[model samples]
Structure formats: C-alpha cells, structure tokens
Target: MYENNLLLERGAARDLPETILLSDFLLDCQVRNFSPRTVQSYKSNLKYFLSRHPIRISPEDLKVFLVHIRDEKGFAQSTVENYFAALSSFNDFLEWEGVIERNVVPQFRKRYLRQYKDQRNEERQLINLEQMRDLIDSAEWICHKAMFVFFAKTGIRRQELIDLDVQDLHVSKRYAVLKPHAKRSNRIVFFDDECAQVLETWLKWRYNRKIRISALFIGVQGSRISRDAVYEAVTEHGLQLGFHNPEGLLNEKFTPHCFRHWFTTWLRRAGCPRAIIQELRGDTRKEAIDIYDHITQDELKEDYLKYIPKLGIKL
Candidate 1:
C-alpha cells in the first residue's frame, strides 16, 4: 500500500498556482498498472517543471513558459521535451475532469516540434577473459572470489547483486530473482552447474566462519554488500593481480556498470540473440532486446570457453 504522503501535501493546491494536482494523476497511473518507477519519474518531472513555472496563467501561456525554460533556464531540448510529456499527461487528466476545456500541452507538440531522446547514455567497457581470470586468481577472500565469479558469469546489475538475499537464490531450481532498488524492473538470472558449484563452495566457507547473515554477500558490519563495497572488491583484486595500477584501475568514471556493459557486449559477440541478452540483463525495453537478435547460446558458450578455459565445468 503506497501512501499518498509525497504526492499530496497540505495546501499544495493553493500554493502551486499553475500545476494541477499531480497526485491524482499519479494515482490514476498507479491504478493503470504503470511500473512504480515510471510513475515516480512522471511525478518528479511534472512537479519540477510546474514548481519552477508556478504563476497564475491561462493554458495558452504554456508556450512562453516552455520557451523561457529553454532560453533562460538553459534546459536542453531533450529535457524540455520530457517536461512537455509529463505536463501533457497531467493536463490530459485535468481536461478529462473538466478542469480545462482544451489540451494545451498536446498543442505544444505541434507548436515546438520537440523531439525526445534518452540522455542517460551508458559507456561500454569490455572486460576480456584474461582480465577476469587475473582478478579471480588474486581474490584474497573466498566470498570476494565468489562475487567475481558470479558477476563474470551472470552479468547481473550492480544493484541487483547488491540486493541479492540468500533466500532469493533457489539452488535446486537453478535460478535467482533479484529485486533492485530501482522500480523499473526485477531480474531473474539463471545459474549453470559451474556457477552453482563455485557458489556452493563459497557458501561452505562462509558456514565455517560461524556468522549469521541473510545477505549472500556481506560487508565488514555484516550488512548486505553495497555498490561501493562490490566495486572496491573488484578493483582491489584487479590491482593485486598486477593487471592494472591501483590508481589507473579504480578511477571514478569506471564502475560496476562497466561490467554489465562488458557482459552484454561479450554475449552479443558470442552469438546470443539481442532479446536473450537483454533478458539476461533484466532489461524490459523492446528496442534494447532487438539489437542483438542474431546470436545463439552455443556460440556464447564457445566464446566463454575460449576466454576462461579454466572454467572446465560445463553447463
């Protein structure tokens, strides 16, 4: 049960002059089964635009408001387009409820001819077989070794791995469902015989330590491994292997997401279909799934073997 605490605040209607009651619109979206993350984004964007442009004005004034944001506020064309989308949905809701007679936001589309593109582009980093082997061989902690092997094999998102709970992994079923902090998607990743065996070995080692923890991976405080911890673990191990200098390898710009990108790229080169690769990475976008539609699992397995020959355990 999501409370409407954030959506509706006291005197919000009176204080917010131009903006509609966005909470109502968000509730509608929720009822329609839109993903929670999508609803949150819509709410955030709409509130940001409206709060910044809060002035008593007619529907026709939206054009001037948009131009002001673009020219004076220095918002990029793409960001402005996203603002229009958020407001358009809210305005449509208002129009339906008799708050306004005309769809002013929809008219902006024809007036501005705005084009929207995703701005959160990710950079690609390919960690080849040799680099991965070196990192694994240098791992001082058995748990860290398991973490490296799990990431190298599965390509789970950094957040997904961070969010992994011991109970979430059903070894008998050969699958794990990771619920990430993001609301966009949940990932269900499979584990083959090799990964399972390594995981089992790590679990045995953990048991011998006689510590109680629900997280598959834990930090110094016995809490779940965070993004920072996982990253440090990877970088430290890589540096220990002499594959990279401490300063050169753990640069701020390079991060766990790079591992995910490398994993996906490797999968594509191995001949796995784009859809399968996207599915493996827990991506929900159809466009993302279409890019590598020509690959096969057999080719991917062969590629993995060529790179990590020590992984003699077969699927």
Candidate 2:
C-alpha cells in the first residue's frame, strides 16, 4: 500500500530502509491531520532509532530499545510515553501499509511508561476568584492588567491567548473567539464585562500610540508577546498575590492553564453542570459534545455571569 514509496517485494519487510518507511509514515501522519509538532516528534524519534538500531525491527529488538530508553537512558514517565507512542504509531502505519505482518507495539503497552505510584497531588495551581482579582491588581501596566484579566476571566489555554488577535475580541458581546489550537478544535469562550472594559481601554491606549500590529496582546516594544513572557508575567504576579496550594503551605506558582482549570472549578462550584463546563473548556465527553449545541450563547453567558465577579473598571 505504500504506492508512492519504494516498491518492496511482498513479504520483504526487512529489505525496506527505515528512512523510506519513515518518510511514508510521516506523509500519512500529515494526511491524517497530525499537528506539525507531532509529525516532527515522529520524524526525530524514528530517525534516532534508525541511527542506533538496525533497519529491520523485530519484537525482540523493540523490547531492547524500550529497556535502553527506560532504564539505560533514565527517561521519565512522560518521555517514555512519548517515545513509545511514536514507535507504536510508526509500527501501526507500516503494518497498515503491509510492510509488516504483525502489530507488536500493542503487546508492549503495559511496560511502556509504566508507573508504580498514584499521581501526586500537586498544589492546586489555580487562583481563587479573590486571588484572581488580586493577581490583576498586581500588574504594573495597562496591557499586563488586561492580559491578566483576560486570562483569569476567559479560561483559554496559553497558546490560544498567544494566537489571539485584536479582531477576535468581541467586546460588544462580552466574549472572545478562541481560535483552534490543539486538535484543530475552535470554540467561543465568554468573559465578564470587567475584562471587556480593560481590553477596550488597552485598545484605546494601543491605537492612540499608533502601534499598527494586529496582535491582541503586545509587549513593551509593541510587538506580539511571546509565550514565555506571558508565563513570567503571570508567575511574577501570582507569587506577589501569595498563590499557594489549598493548604497554603507551599509557594506554588500559577500557570496559564491554571486559569482554564480555575474557570472550570469555579463554574462547577457555581452549580454549572459538568457537561456545560466541558463544553466551555472544549473537552469532549461520552454523553456527546453535540448535545451542548442546544445550550445557546445567551444561556451560557447568563450562567457564566452568575459566577465571575463584576470588577470595577480600571483604566
């Protein structure tokens, strides 16, 4: 089935060069709408394997590779998971293309990324509603204040915030369009009027200065802000506001995704249904994501308004 790839004789899977097979697998990943990051991971991991191991892979060889990475390389649980995922997908692709007769990757699933202990409870990374307001107050600049407000109120992922454009802010509707990031899934997220006011104020200040950039958020130099800058800004303010875990014992830092989690947790505490919260966060549940389509924006907004605070306007 690798029609465009090297024409290997039937049952001659070992004769196929790993690079050529990897090329075919990568093309398939692209066709299947895998993210560029994922494709790159597959390419790098497979090429690394080829660099170290024989072109022809067997179940026995795969077991050795796994041990080498997990034990010898001292890979963490997540790294081991990622490596095997790459291997599994690559093997599946080759098997599907008839290059291999058996799918051995599945048999190795139990050992791959195996964990012995239950997940450790890291301090609750999210800020409370009061802490959120305090975090916003800790911002030194108008732009930082607006960014803090949006992150706290909107609950969008950091990447979504980075990809945000000025045009995506529908201030009049009190919502922002979160363009698809991971999985190419896009959805609307709502925020309170307090956020709207700050964003509008920022826009006014931004326009008055004649900064022609189209980015929604800009740094001191009037260019689009980098992800690291946003993280540092949040962390810097979070520490000042004393954002610790539930026990309030450790100096836990808040992350961008924390806002998203904070939003869900707050919504749940506010009596919003788990299904609706999942819809807002773009997470699919078994009950069917389409069921949420019946929940109108007006209803969503009304439910959201009941929970988030209506902060006083800050210019």
Candidate 3:
C-alpha cells in the first residue's frame, strides 16, 4: 500500500497527511479506471470521516462511528449513506490486508422524501434558439463568443471544456474530442455548421494576433483557461441576456452539466434514437435513452423551427 503513493504523485491532496492504507485504496480505484471525480468524492468523504472520527480500533468501531454520524451530526440520510459507503470500502480493504478480521459497516440506501410536489412540469430550462442568438449577439469579447458557441453547439460538460485541447477539434469530421479527466473519458461530440463558422472566424482573428498558446482557450500570459473562467463567462452571459438571473439563477441552477442535459433533452425532443443519444452523450445505460429517445430529426426540426429560427442549413 505504501508504494501506492507514488502513482498519486500528480493527483493527491497535499494538505492532507499521507496514509499507506488510504493511498493503497485510492491506487486500487485508479487501477479500476474509475473516473477521477468519483475517486475524489470517495476520497473526500473518507477524509472527512477520518478528520472528524479519529479512532483506531477493530471493525466494531466503524459501526459506532456510523451511529454517531446519524445521531449526533444530524447529517442528512443521503450524506450519512455516503459516509457509510466510504467507511465500508475502507473496512473491506483493512480486512483484505489482514489488518482486521471483520467488516461491520452496514449497507444503507438513500432516499429523498419530498414534502412538496415535484416541479418537473415547469418548462425544461434550456436556452432556446432565440436566447442563444441573443447571447451570441451580446457577447463583446471574441473569447466569450467562442466559448459560448463551443458549449451551446457541442454540449460538453464544463470540465471537459476546460480540459479540451486544440488538437481535440477535428475540423474535417465536424466533431470535437471531449476527453475529461473525470466522468466520460473520451467522447466524440459533433457540432452544427453555424458554430463551426463562428469558431473558424475566431481562430482566424486569433491567429493573426501573435498568440502562440496550444490551448484552444488561452488566458492572460497564454495559460490555458480554467473551468472557473468558463463558468463565469457563461453566468455573466446568461444574466446579460435575461436568460437567467445573476443571483440564485443562471449558473447555480443551470451549471456546465446543464448544457449536456440540454443537448440530451433537445435530441430527445428532436427524435434522435435512444441508442444514438446514449452513444453521443457517453451514457453507459441504454434504458434512459430508450425511455426518452423516441423522436426523429424531421419531427424535432418541426418542433424546433417553431422556436429556433431558420438555420438555412439542412439537418
């Protein structure tokens, strides 16, 4: 397990003290190809437990720790469930290593009992064609315009956009490579003609300027733009266009994940096959695509044209 620390040279949290056992478990997760985000969440949950409940003993101590979280911390049922998951994994590792004889963390399920009715009927909050046009028209900077165009058309997650490399954009294929360190490893996402045109224009303008950064989106000093910058850009744009409010709305409600949601939802409304949608969105399960992917391009075009102005380009 101590050897596991070497593999985490790039990813481990520096502020936290090193643990041979914890490092080993994390290394195992990495070997399993679990998404970095999932690994981080699991690590965070385990770290929080270790920080608060620092007692070293047999497996029975774990059961006592769970009870304390439930009875004393007043943590939500879901949060407690996550804590149980973290500890359960740790206990299993200890046993496998022969450090402990038994595993005692009880498995528990999480449920959210809503007091009020679900608001799903509320119109799916997506940027319609008109709102999208307004957003593009109002963008004052080339960077902001390019960023909005990239997301609105490609429908990638925020982190994916942050990690995007210039080489990832396959202009000939009309697709962009979305290879994030977390979640979906590498997915090919296609874009529309208008977005391609917008990006080409931006690239031309940028090329003439003397920027030598390899990153698609460069910040001051020619550094790659961070995820936070993209978040801020989208949030400000949404607010300026009255698409969403700056406070409590815009990004807080619609986040970078929402763009992917919008894409999936739009594809469903447009009548794309569930299998195709799943393939496009990099979803592992086909059940959701089956449930939602029932529309066709013709039907979707008819529905969308009612809201989205004439694209002039045929689908």
**Which regions of candidate 1 deviate over 4 angstroms?**
1-123, 180-186, 241-254, 285-315
In candidate 1, list every pair of residues with a backbone clash: 271-295, 271-296, 274-292, 274-293
Candidate number with the higher lDDT (1 or 2): 2
Better of 1 and 3 by lDDT: 1
- Tens-digit lDDT string for candidate 3 (162-259): 77777888765567777754555237666666767777776777788976677888664568887677777776777766666544533344445566
- Return the number of clashes found in candidate 3: 3
Superposition TM-score, candidate 2 onto the true structure: 0.76
- Give the CA lDDT, 0 to 100, for residue 3 in model 1: 43
Candidate 3 residue 106 C-alpha distance from true site, Å: 6.5
Query: Best by TM-score, which number?
Result: 2
Which tens-of-lDDT digit does each residue in 148-169 have in candidate 2? 8887777777778887899888
Per-model TM-score, in order, reads: 0.55, 0.76, 0.65
lDDT of each: 0.65, 0.75, 0.62
lDDT of 2 at 266: 80
lDDT for 55 (candidate 1): 31
Error of 1 at 22 (Å): 15
What's the residue-level lDDT of 99 in candidate 2?
78
Compare the candidates by lDDT and give the number of the best one: 2
Model 3 misplaced stretches (Cα beyond 4 Å): 1-18, 37-45, 55-92, 98-106, 109-124, 180-186, 219-221, 246-252, 285-315
